[model samples]
Target: MRSTFYTEDHEAYRASVAEFLRREVEPHHGEWEAAHGIPAEVWTSAAAAGLMGLAVPEEYGGGGEPDYRYRFVVAEEIARTNTTSFGVGLGLQDDIVIPYLLDLATDEQKQRWLPAMAAGELIGAIAMTEPGTGSDLQGIRTTAVRDGDDWVLSGAKTFISSGMHAGLVIVVARTDAEAGSRGFTLFVVEQSDAGFTRGRQLEKVGLDAQDTAELFFDGVRLTADRILGQEGMAMRYLMERLPRERLSIAAAAVAASEAAVRWTLEYVHSRTAFGQPIGDFQNTRFVLAELETECDIARAYVEKAALALNLGELTAVEASKAKWWTSELQVRATSRCLQLFGGFGYMLEYPIARAFRDARVQTIYGGTTEIMKEIIGREQAARYARR
Candidate 1:
């Protein structure tokens, strides 16, 4: 189906993104992957190309475009280039980290952080997953005890994306143990803080260029001004912002799946076996047909959700469905596509090989598939009970 999700403006933006990838990202992505890190210049280059902060307001040095289609274009272009590590790093900044500051930070806080973030001069990470906690935000062990005019923070966070180079980290810490969910509060922890430390860069199975690390806060003292939004409302904030994050992941999943199918289709049509193109085989045709159909369906749903998100009508339940379904589809799409490539698929030099590896993490992060299903199930049960 021809979708009306994007306009001429979006296509124009897409061209720019494609050009940006060709000029700035593609040339250096392999080296970054090998080094397990992206350099600061890439971020600034993205910012210079007006790709860094589309949602950020123009007054603060951003493009001031809140429309989600622009972001989708960026994701699609990045997926086409197969520079997913750079894409993930950028997504963390735009989707997860900047949104928090944009929505929750005070004017003072925004002034201090937003401009640099918009310029891509400063990187940010949100540290929510603890050593003991995965999906349960309530289970975080990080604590922040209030002193006269300061708060003493102590805890550890793991699996933090952009952890190694983030100059500013939004750390979720427990401030009032008795308040349960409300007890958790968000604090901005800067790299210059006395006791803030970053552990060794975590080696991951995929997203090699995107840095992940363990962060430690030992007796780190924060002034009252460091609190993000209202104290003891971190849970509410996290819940509110998660749909965007999940949807971001979902959009990437669709783009990756689509790109995988495109690459595989091209390869099968050209690569010959038994005096015929591999695509001539009924089995190959069937597989590609199914993969394309699934990608289409996922894209339609994601488009609807993206439109809903722009209208601020996207719900957690809706985003969860998109996130889990499309992510799993991406994994399946890449795996099947890789299989079609035969022995060549396993070779790291092939884009499909890297796509296969990168797609595996889609189901694990943002939120697990199990957790997404549970959220949908619980919501359904509640609706049934009310009826």
Candidate 2:
């Protein structure tokens, strides 16, 4: 069944995204993967193609569109090309970082940052996870001490996506020792800040073109203007924005799974065994049938969730459900699809090999499957208790 989730405008945007990828990303993505970083030019090219900053207002030099389906179209197109490294990098910008600034930055701050970010001249990242911290924001050890006219920050962040290229980073730090949850604050740290330095880019098994690195702040100083939102409101801000972030992941998962099935379907129809095409085999037919059904179901759920997010009705519980379920589905879909390709799937030349590797991290990042389950479980228990 055809999904009515996207409008003609969204489909039109999807066509432009596909053309942009074919012209700019497809030819050079493998080179980027080998280099462990995408060139700065690609960012500018994407911005020129109007692929960046769909949610930023027009005053900031963006498309001024906030519809989540536009972003979903971009994800779907990128997944089709199997250039997920590029998708992951851009996801950090649009899904994670830009939303923070749009929601939290003061008007002056927006004027200062949004224009450049929308232009792809200033890449942004959020520094929340530490070497020891993953999923627990309260456990962040980065500290920011108040001075007469400055805040002295000292901390290290690990696994920061776009760390190598981000011109600005939102650093989460503990500002008070006794306030517990209210103790944390967010600081906008610039790359040019004195005493701020980037550690080596960390390597990973997937999304190799996207740079993840360790960041170090040794008494980096910031003025009051650098604060994002109110002091001690960082936790609240993070919680509020998570629905969009997780839903972004969920949408991408659905797209990637669908693409994997498409690729596997193409491969099975052409590759033959036992004097017939593999797709003609009963086992292959059954596997593709199962994958397609699941992909369809996941797509429906994600489309509904996207609508909920647009309407501000998506709860953290629902977002967590979408995030965990579709991510796990992506892993399953890619793995099973890869199996259908036989030995070719294991080769780097095949897109399935890359998809398999890239799918592994979907269930890990944006909060783990375990954490998502816990959130849902706790919500369920709370409802039962209320009853």
TM-score to native of every candidate shown: 0.99, 0.99
Index of the highest-lDDT prediction: 1
> Residues 1-387, candidate 1, lDDT per residue (tens digit)?
587899999999999999999998999999999999999988988998988888889988999999999999999998999999999988998999999999999999999999999999999999999889999888999999999999999999999999999999999999999999899999999999999999989999999999999999999999999999999899999999999999999999999999999999999999999999999999999999999999999999999999999999999999999999999999999999999999999998999999999999899898999999999999999999999
lDDT of each: 0.95, 0.94
For residue 35, give model 1's deviation from the true position in Å: 0.5
Q: Candidate 2 lDDT, tens digit per residue, 246-334?
A: 99999999999999999999999998899999999999999999989999988888899999888989999999999999999999999
Cα shift from native, residue 7, model 1 (Å): 0.8
Worst 10 residues of 1 by lDDT: 50-59
Off by over 4 Å in 2: none
| Model 2: colliding residue pairs | none
Name the runs in model 1 displaced over 4 angstroms: none
lDDT of 1: 0.95
